[model samples]
Target: MESSVPALPSVLLKDGELKDVEAKPVIIGGMVLDIHATPSVPANPRTTTPGKVHYILGGVARNVAECMSKLGAKPYMISVVGLDMAGNLLLEHWKSAGLSLDVAAESGIPVWFEPVSVVKSKRVVSVVKHITFASPNEDELIAMANALSCGEVFSPIQKDNKKNKCSTESLFQMLRPAIWVLLEEGIKVVVVTLGSDGVLLCSNGAPGFMKGSSKGSNPHGSGNQLYRLVNSSCPPNRFFSASKFEGGSNLFAAHFPALPASVVRLTGAGDCLVGGALACICAGLNVMQSLAVGIAAAKAAVEVDTNVPTEYSLAKITDDAKSIYFATKMMFCQSML
Candidate 1:
């Protein structure tokens, strides 16, 4: 008898929905954990408030994966968990939620509390080296910025003078060179998320598109080209030349406003936004449309306590995107005035 070979898994796209996608799983690599917390307002010092304690699945990357799974996308979790009951339960929960955990591994449980916060800090200089190695989205970029500016990460400015002001703009300016360096590594898009202020989108060109000269002479060259910033919501006539490289491509930048929404808790909103945006992208939506969907998902996420969204909530986010899309267009037009 002849030996039989296993068939490779395939992903299918239909009617703007990613179906039966076993191979093309959204790989989320980060922390994963079960969070136990007591609800307390103002969080009185040294006093235990009378409130109901609850346990929930929590973690940046894990939450993102769960939200993506809820939004009908196959998400694969790449995380380390402790060899304990909590870890076992967390893994079981992920399995029940239809998330793929083949990439997850066993390790020590990373726990934290109010007084003792998680202290996973790294230098900005070192972080930039890792970030430029891959194409990270807006939320991930913002997280890095937060880590750098919050005094958690070591900074030369902080070392030189503790009183030196460290605004977000200053940090971005400092990191601009690092962002430019990413271009040499084939990174075409750089998204910066500004909470409530909105998102700043920077791109050299569409992903996978060949770099060409703006003069319309050659179709392909040494990957050096001029790039223009086009507001997704603005009229086609409006365009801004961001910058140009001598023998490379330029970077384009644009800002989009955040949609208004009611808030109950802001725990997993960013994760939801990232997950929703990625899912929309996988479903073949354009960058702007995917962003709009992400904003809508975040709006929905803030209204709920749980990080994992239900199917109904995901559908509601899709419905909310329609209105948010128009609102963004109006906001973009007003900004141009």
Candidate 2:
């Protein structure tokens, strides 16, 4: 028997309002989780508040999937969530958004989340204590252990006490095989957004990187201001000195180097960027064009204070693309030797 998971047959959305409209083409599959936390509102000195709190569904996969749905694309999420309220909330949202949730893995683990607080006056002065993960089932654990022995599984190196340094390898292990199945099923475009490095596109094993601008502010205000000052004061053309690469893709490629912004809030930007890129692809753009769209979308995301802006506009996304379009064109023209 083949070791491949069968693709779910396409379900037509026949709801009265959307029946006639042309459906956007795209399927984003991955994990989704809730983020519950209280942000520190830094004052003149330094203090903490104990009043209101905020909670939202936020995972890299969730963020991108929701963003794509909002942009009129069909995003299908596949990952584990426990049999708890958090899981229920996630499924409810996905259903409401008109996204496909055919392959979701409902784990038998706890679903509650913990809150965190950041003292810095950057994005949201506070942070989440940690993210909640669904305990892997027996099959998942066996599969992960098996893949590890074969060198098909690897974990991110520990980078100190930073929250971002924690292991996401568990999620990746689940995603890899599912995505390979997606590839075999004619989904040629597959994107994995690595926070600071940029995005990774895989098709027919020809993977590439999209370099980030490294020029961004924190998702909030103060740090964002600081990044702007640094960029303005520095010599104009020296912003992207860190980028060195060649492009020109037959199928898969990356373009993070095109971004020269300082990363601040590193929260929903990756999702927004992926959504933007996918949207561009749905709009009939190629790899270079999609990178421009994705980067611009990330720029739009970082320029906001809240995680998901209510007024999430795409104009800045367009402007950001225009700013780097020529540079990407040049990179694509160069051979990757």
Candidate 3:
């Protein structure tokens, strides 16, 4: 299917009234029961360690939906769950939060795609060219790249080399071909997460295309502060160098360093990053500005035991985002190699 998941828009014209507008985020995917366990102390190989375990709701799409809600967006989610205990718990939370299972659709909103798993990743190749954004971790990016290219896109790497790889420049260089495959296929922006190292954002030179969307905190506040700190337009000067393709198309890319975080569970970091960016994007920030918020959100996820934080501090989110946004030295306009 080209699209079963609906996109997001800030204003929904309702009941044929142009004056009646609502901001609704449409989310589609699974809502899983996430079990978290942390040992209180180091244990011997043959014995069990005293630990804490908790169940949390998790799914790439679901996490993104919930994170957006925390950031103040009414996101209507679509997913399946059983009538069993886990399913009931999941449903109860949705009901309590007022996340919708049924809602009418809208037109002309940004579309974001998530590769739920490596196995299910290839299934979306047919719909790739239509999406506005795709957030894929290393493995999923490889899987989708191979599928999109109709063959292997990344050369095999040694196990040790893969583990020690952290430099954004080096990583982007190795993954350029694979990343380009997606860009040429028509996905507008690619946000690749590098655990602990930071995030790399690549666009077909249109990061500001969504600039006019009405989104964010009281328009006069931090919601629009990050983008104002650094320029998103210009022929890639000090912030980044310009790289032009053979066809003369310009690509804008940037490497945003990860924030210093007190690490905990790493499971939901990437998912929350996507969620944060989506929230800001829906609020009308450009991709560059939205990504800073995404990184800030990931930092919050790591400090907690759950996949998504119970709540996010707008003050902290904005502060951290500004730092990353201003400091991002883009490799966006050129090939690192």
Candidate 4:
């Protein structure tokens, strides 16, 4: 979200005709073939256990675009999926969805970047310096912080100690330096994803984020059924800030709990989470609503083997997202140097 990779204008199909609007939002990243091998029973790592293997279309960017498409936005993907069997599968599925394969050289759309790893995550320092939003895990967070700081400034937290298991509060404190670095580097929002514990959304007091409405979508006419449903469920109960709190007085951070789910595989939870949020942002929901919707999408991902749920239930997403959005609270908001 460095500038605005979202705010996808509502493009609806009415009476078998395409709605008048701007070009489709563009997504730049990878189109990879994901091979998943699951064992039927617990066994030693040295031996392969009897399990099922399936080939699926996956890539961080691809997953996000697919998720956005499922949520009702036709995003033009910019990535490398060549004329091979795997590439054809990826393209065919996207083509089937009515998503555009067209790639524009530069559209100036807002960009949202996800760290691929601890090392390569540093490759996008320039991107970070101008990024409006980022979601980095623990190691990647520290790495980006180091690159931003122009030095080795952080170390991994040791979780083996029973007395110092790095609880949420402590984790926040430890990563606060890193978060501070990212925020200072012009990154507007830094969402730290903690497995099971949920997410930490930190910001350098970005405008409209903690206020009235930060929705990114601009609807044209009636909009689609799904996008309309999406807009209705946003602006969480507590999205409005009380007058008592001084504006832009402190760094902002909030915690959202992970929804309870029947476990399957966690391989795609984080990817789907980003996908869901990006989709909502494009659909015109504010950050809180979008994140909630994203989490709901992730819940769906964990329930199924696919990186993204084959189909999303707007009703179910709204219901589950409302709970998360309402329950979320600003856990930290104080001036910190």
* TM-score of candidate 3 versus the correct structure, residues matched by position: 0.77
- Most TM-score-accurate candidate: 4
Runs with alpha carbons beyond 4 Å of true place in candidate 4: 1-4, 7-23, 39-51, 95-108, 160-166, 210-224, 230-237, 242-249
Clashes of 1: 2
Which candidate, 2 or 4, would have the higher TM-score against the true structure?
A: 4
The ten-residue window of minimal lDDT in model 2 covers 108-117
Which digits, one per residue and each the tens of the lDDT, describe model 3 over residues 1-337? Answer: 1122334442321111111133445777778898878799987798889999888898777788888778765667777888899999889887422233223222445567777667787765776745767877677778888999888757633333655764667677777777777887888778787777688788766344423333322242322443332223211123322222222266666788898999988878877887787766555455666788889999999999889998888777878887887788766455322
Over 4 Å off, model 1? 1-23, 34-36, 39-48, 96-185, 205-248, 327-337
Between prediction 3 and prediction 4, the one with superior lDDT is 4
- Residue 160 error, candidate 4, Å: 5.9
lDDT of 2 at 228: 38
Per-candidate Cα lDDT values, in order, are: 0.44, 0.39, 0.65, 0.68
Candidate 4 lDDT (Cα, whole model)? Answer: 0.68
Where is the poorest 10-residue window by lDDT in model 4?
10-19
Model 1, 164-183: lDDT tens digits are: 64544454454454344444
Which RMSD values do the candidates have, in order?
12.6, 15.0, 6.3, 6.0
User: Over all chains combined, what TM-score does candidate 2 have?
Assistant: 0.45
lDDT of 2 at 95: 49
Candidate 3, which segments miss by more than 4 Å at Cα?
A: 1-22, 38-52, 96-108, 156-166, 208-248, 332-337
Better of 1 and 2 by TM-score: 1
- Please provide, for model 4 over 1-337, each residue's C-alpha lDDT reduced to its tens digit, 9 standing for 90 to 100: 1112553322211111122343355666777899988788987777768989899888877888788778777676667777899988888777522222221113323456788577767865766544567888888898888988788978876554756466777778777888888887777678888777788888766334433123344453322554566556655335555323445546778788788999887877887888778766655445676788788888888998788888888799878887787777676556555
What lDDT does candidate 2 reach at residue 37? 59
